[model samples]
Target: MFVIGLTGGIGSGKSTAGEIFAELGVDVIDTDQIARLLTQSGGAAIPAICGLFGDAYITESGALDRQKMRQLIFSDSAHRQKLERLLHPLILDEVSSHVQRSLSQYVIVVVPLLLETGDYDHLIQRVLVIDCDEQLQVTRTMARSRLSAADVKAIMATQVDRQFRLTKADDIVRNNRDFGHLRAQIVRLHHFYLTLAE
Candidate 1:
């Protein structure tokens, strides 16, 4: 099975492209989703996070306080690295198990920090990058998450820049236009990825 790394800068519409690929029946594993799952009640990473960040990081329902945790990690590089240390290994292992169980002809694993993480590289056969304008990213993220301009820009800074991501891509889907144009890019990329698999 082929593993493709689907990545993009924050608010670059990675989810939109990922969904389109999913509709085309390519197995898609979203790392952000797995990260969220890890913090949910009864998840593998919850205990370690609680132990490190303390019990206060968890809610009465036994869920990680994601907003609080986000602030903690983003503010402190040491804290962020510590969290990644505890979580990345378990995440990769579980993802591998998931892919093994599914036995896909090809799989798309979407990672927002695919470059920054350095946890995966040679593991993926291809790198698919979703491209767009920086100002557009600010606009879309602000519209969706209602984050302050400073906060959005900070998040963008944490990941690899757009040009660097494009430089590393085996494929690129440009998303600097309307929904219809975005959809067309996805349609074409879907066929392209499938053909490579064959």
Candidate 2:
């Protein structure tokens, strides 16, 4: 299937963009959702994560303690890399399976770290980045995740800067406005992608 890799930094509204595409009948696969599944109770990655990061990172319910893990990764670059090394392959495998079985005209793979990781380069035919102002990103994320402005800034720091992400996009969706504006843009792209899929 032709794959459109949708990416944006935290709080850039990529999830909303993906949902818009999904409403237009496009199949959407989100790596973040897959990652969460893999770290849930009795999940595939729990054993490896426990062995690598120790048991403290695992909740009593046998799921990943995301807050603890997030703090660790943000504090130590090496630990971040280690976590990626463990999760990336598994996530990619699941993504591939979903793409193969999908019946939609084209698949929109929502990968927030598409540029930062570069693992989906060969799998995607087009890169669609959801763009927005940096301050807006920080504000949206702080509200949604209850993170302090500084903590949100720290997460933003780990992602590719806005300018760089824009440069890497094959298509860009400006998301600095209201939902109606975003839906209109997505509706336009839906038609564009349908033609490409043919």
Candidate 3:
């Protein structure tokens, strides 16, 4: 099936865009969601994570201690790489399973780090990037996640720069405006994708 790799920086409205595609009857597989599931209590990745990082990273409820892990990874790139090494393959396998089971004419795999990882290239026919200004990204992320501006900027620093991300997109949706504008672009793209699928 035709696949679109939907990606954008944090707070660039990727989840919103994915929801619009889903509302239009497209299959939307989100890798971040899959990752979350894997790291949650009794998740597939838990045993390995516990073994590798120890029980310190696992909360009393058996879920990942996201805040602690986030701090570690942000402070040390090596820790981030180590965690990615453990999780990326599992996420990819689950994503492939979802794609194969998808019933829609096309699929949108939302990977926030799509361009940075380059692992989903084989699965996507095109790239759809949600674009917004850096300030918007910082503000939106801070507002939604309750992360301080420094924390938001730190996450943004890990992602590919805006211009680089835009340059790689096969299609772009500028999401700095209101929901109506964002939805209008998504509606237009929805129809265009339908034609492409046919």
For residues 121-189, write the lDDT of model 3, one tens digit per residue. Answer: 899999999999889998999889999999999999999988999999999999999999999999999
lDDT of each: 0.85, 0.95, 0.94
Stretches of candidate 3 exceeding 4 Å from the true structure: none
Q: Which consecutive 10 residues in model 2 have the weakest lDDT in total?
A: 17-26
Top candidate (lDDT)? 2
Clashes of 2: 0
- Return the TM-score for each candidate structure: 0.95, 0.99, 0.99
- Two-way lDDT contest, 1 vs 3, winner: 3
lDDT of 2 by residue, 1-198 (tens): 899999999999999999988888899999999999999999999999999999999999999999999999999999999999999999999999999999999999999899999899889999999999999999999899999999999999999888999999999999999999999999999999999999
Model 1, span 35-73: residue lDDT tens? 889889988788889889899889888999988887887
Q: What is the lDDT of candidate 1?
A: 0.85
Better of 1 and 3 by TM-score: 3
> Candidate 3, TM-score vs. the true structure?
0.99
Q: Candidate 3, residue 85: CA error in Å?
A: 0.9
